[model samples]
Target: MSNKTIKIGQLDMELQSIFSAFEHHVHTAVDTAAEKTAEEAVKKLKKTSPKNKRAKRGKKYKNGWKYKKTSEGMTVYNEQYQLTHLLENGHDIIINGEVRGHAAAHEHIAPVEAWAQDEFPEEFKRQVGKG
Candidate 1:
């Protein structure tokens, strides 16, 4: 009769366990990674948004943008609202929405200029005075 013993090292056993665990949770790992990325993005956004004082608010997500509220505001994600650029005036003041970016010309509304000038007295004054 012959007898033989097979031995696996501690490191090899640990590696096997880790690989098995990783394989078992592969789908969860991917989902968790995506969720974490989204969570981080929201956290970054919360840092910049006004705490709680907007009758209305807006977000712009185009090409690395930032928003600073001089006054209180509120926003509903898909709703379009009026916006004026701080740097550009050649184009008429436009209306925009926060789909995935900060305000830009692509979502601009031509009629919003009239509304801003006529309806939002204070906002209209400030923007016009800026010119």
Candidate 2:
């Protein structure tokens, strides 16, 4: 390699361009990984969510899983927002304003959360490696 000398202003511009390209690359990889994880979380949630097969209108919690792209980042959520926490953590079954028994939690979101914690890092590495 031949040695070259550059002026200060030119050096600054060159460094800026190089940094910009690198920043773009890193951001693209991170965004791709986040999107993949979000999609997978939705799919897994749909699979694991409780469903009422007998419902005439077929309004199942499994079908309520959704993902959103936000200014902050990706997000996976249930369209049946009110039921998520109750279903996940279980709640007392009440009848006529009196407690009867407890409903067992199905444990859907927790498992997906555990999976994502492991999945995101691997996905990011794979995406970056694609370069």
Candidate 3:
């Protein structure tokens, strides 16, 4: 019988290449997923936003929703308007130190949150070819 020795150097190199490829794929998939999520969130926000009756023809609250990508992830926000937080959380419409009424919260983020929770994992999985 002839003695045979296994060479692990080639196997290690092949594994390294495979891991590198996998890393690249994962990064690309995550970036794509993030962008999609942001876009979907903005769309949902716009669809669910409360219409401002007093808004001018070119100044609609729904059109304020926008998104941007950050180093950690994507963020959905209103670039032109700053009342998103108040609109989402609601506030007491007080007059002359007396509580006249309350403005009900018009939720937009909650739906987006639910959507991301329910859909993000699957989307990421699909993108990464694990679905």
Write out the backbone clash pairs for model 3. Answer: none
Ranking by TM-score: 2, 3, 1
- In model 2, how many backbone clashes occur? 0
What tens-digit string does per-residue lDDT give for candidate 3 at 1-131? 23545478776876687788889999889888888888888888878888777667444678788889877688888865677787889999999999999999988778788897787778888899852
Per-residue lDDT tens digits for candidate 2, residues 11-121, read: 888788878888898899999999999999999998888876687745667888899889988989988889999989999999999999998897899999999989999
- The candidate, 1 or 2, that scores higher on lDDT is 2
Q: For residue 79, give model 1's deviation from the true position in Å.
A: 6.9
Better of 1 and 3 by TM-score: 3
- What is candidate 2's TM-score against the reference? 0.87
Error of 1 at 80 (Å): 6.3
lDDT of each: 0.37, 0.89, 0.80
For model 3, state the Cα shift of residue 29 in Å.
0.7
A best-first ranking of the candidates according to their lDDT comes to: 2, 3, 1
User: Which ranges in model 3 have alpha carbons more than 4 Å from their true place?
Assistant: 1-7, 57-59, 96-98
